[model samples]
Target: MVIAVRTKNTQTVSDYNCNGRHVFTQTRELERPLVGSILQSMWGVSPTHLTWSALHNSTLVDYSWSVGQTPFGPFSEMSTLSFAQKDAARRNVLLTSLNYSISSAIDVLDSVAAHGGERKLLKHNQYVEFVQRWSLFKYKLDKAVSALSHFDFELALYYLRSLDHDLYGAHAIVYHASQELEASLACFKDPPFPWATVSVYAVCVVAFIYVYMKRDKLFRNKRKQF
Candidate 1:
């Protein structure tokens, strides 16, 4: 996720790379997150896509934003705006995208539960704990959305990233549950017969019968000679 932002003075965009991420003049710096999030969603690059596109195409919409222009929807509208409006637009883009991502992720978790496969797929304790953890995350997600709507980005960002540890736990629980399910399924599978052992026993029995028949014949001949 390397973003190189330069002013119109920069003719050769390819040659320049900066160590610090924030290279824009004061105005552009504030707009970076909003622009980045929308572009990431639209472009489907570096991270998850913002909007759905054709399976082969990375970008849902081909669009870019410029200074002093309202980057609204798929189309740009030229409008006059005070500094406050510009700030509001930036906040809206960032918070709205964050809300969408959180909702999508939570929906997947809920869908898994809705399938009624949790009992067969997950251990009793694991299923219970995962439900509890996801419930907590859902609560925080609601709080984060509320905070973002109220323009409290700092608190929203805090709550959004706070799911890191619980997310890891969720992943671990799912992995272990899948493994357990695989083992259980394997138990129901029929095992292959040991054909090699059976063949060896068959050969030994034939050889023993041959040897006994030969001995019996030899003894009859000896008795007839006597």
Candidate 2:
């Protein structure tokens, strides 16, 4: 059971009422800086003050879940089991998503390497940066896995999300490099072999040789005529 309470001032609140459901209350002030700080601490990202307003707006919707009409057993035991099942489900989802992302990134890296023109396509500085970013991405993924193993889902999630920037930059670099390589290749043209010119030259040489070989007979006739 989840109960959300919104109050203007803590001291002036007279009624704390929820319809007989157990309350797991976490209180936070509606102040922007505090909310931003909390978000930064949790997600390792600094969000704008508008995040607080968005959060406030989201609280307007009441959401509930059914734990399958509580079995005829001890209430506490059933509640504990339900919580455990939910936690396991959450962990499974996280693991699946992390694995998918890792595999996709690996495929992208493989494609980049397989393009076979790293030296021609990417500058030395770009190659260095790509290597560094790839290493960092792997390191973060390792950390995320470690965190997951230790049941630190929040940390794992944060690590997983944080790699987006590096991954995107690497992707952009590869994409642009591939585009440049393709453009350069497209602009290149192999001049056709000059077969006709070579044939003409060969004919001229043969004619000159024949004339030379027949020169004695031609000169004898000319002398007779003289």
Candidate 3:
């Protein structure tokens, strides 16, 4: 359902074809990833997660990496830092690294929920946050995948980059989860409660109750409606 027709402007604008599928404008650097994203969708892999895995794993191998020519320039290369920047007002990154991070985190969210990972962080509200944000993320991801499938790279990139705010928020949740886990483990290893101090508190409570009852009765007998 994809078509490639020449327009008078020669700027290569993409839009819907006769069969209702998107058409490709130009074969930019995003073409391969777009096709790969479509294939990943068919194969039941998340496009965002796949992007994360590629970037994350690649970074472990090489700290410095860059993608091909973006709207910025052919010489300009996209990186995780560049993609995750908040000031990208014009043309956003080739791929949204933060968006991918959230997608990757959502995949493991079940594990975190099952093992009290989120609970340890005391971020029960994040469950709701994740659910709502993830729903939106999925919607955008679906649109991106669809756009990519029909070779609408610009729209696909737009949708992918649009998830930055939600993804950045997700990063905070993940950070808290890790911090909570560490704090709990560290604190749990401390010495047991001071039983001797607790016994002292118990005796004080018993003595206070005895004195109060005796004083109340003495006062009641003397103050009888006088």
Candidate 4:
């Protein structure tokens, strides 16, 4: 989701685009596993007015950090610093997150090979790993575009340098990110359902996995909060 961060620059407020993507960010950067479970639950949630409005109005809360533009409730407060102090820290955080996602996605996919998990039944923890990889794939694509919005080119480069680790999956991400950049002005003009599309899809995928694969074991267990 594109959160236009309007900063009070004296009398004139300037709008700066900050993409707040907390789920994938938490998973990759903060090493949070519950983030994936949260996405899964959001997808299958029985839609109600409270849930809908909460998701709709809850955009990125942090303006200074490298938060991707997301509609889901995953964002956190920016690092404890002023906006200017956050610029460099944000870039580093983005870079670290991209690296972590790429590495984690590759490992999870490799672990889930047909022969990898031979246990007859599905394990909740194991399924959580699957959710993360699926999420990592989509998020890598969406975040690539969001990174560009916040001048996170170095972070992009970091992801590119490691493309060899998973070239096949990386192709879709790299390709989509380019198309997204080309369409940025169009998105900036109207946003055109960027976060809504990605987050909704993420929510659905997670919910499906939780219900069909994990069978509510995930929800029954208390998840650690971000």
Candidate 4 per-residue lDDT, tens place, 1-226, comes to: 2123333342221243325422323322322223323323433322111222365675334333323322223343232333333353455555565666667656544544433341322245544544544555565556575765668776665554444344444334333333433222434465476887899999999998778877566555645331
**lDDT for each of the candidates?**
0.59, 0.61, 0.53, 0.44
Q: Report the number of clashing residue pairs per model.
A: 1, 0, 0, 13
Please write out the lDDT profile of model 3 over residues 26-82, one tens digit for every residue: 444454444434333433322222234464564232212222322222222331223
Name the lDDT of candidate 3: 0.53
TM-scores for every candidate against the unseen true structure: 0.41, 0.46, 0.33, 0.22
1-226 per-residue lDDT for model 2 (tens digits) = 2233556544332233335644332233334334334434443332211123375664232222212322111111122224444455567767876987788788767877788755665789889888887888888889889999988888988888887667877888888777766434456689999999999999999999999999999999999999
Off by over 4 Å in 2: 1-81, 182-226
> In terms of TM-score, which candidate is stronger, 2 or 4?
2
lDDT of 4 at 150: 68
lDDT over C-alpha atoms for residue 45 of model 1? 26
Can you tell me which runs of candidate 3 are displaced by over 4 Å?
Answer: 1-103, 106-122, 181-226
Q: lDDT, candidate 1, residue 93? A: 62
Tens digits of lDDT, candidate 1, 54-120: 7956556433333334433322223344354445555666566676656756665675665456776
- Give RMSD (Å) of candidate 4 vs. truth: 33.2
Q: Which regions of candidate 4 fall more than 4 Å away from where they truly are?
A: 1-86, 114-137, 152-226
Model 4: weakest 10-residue lDDT segment is 43-52
Residue pairs in steric clash, candidate 2? Answer: none
Which sequence of candidate numbers ranks them by TM-score, best first? 2, 1, 3, 4
Off by over 4 Å in 1: 1-93, 96-100, 103-116, 183-226
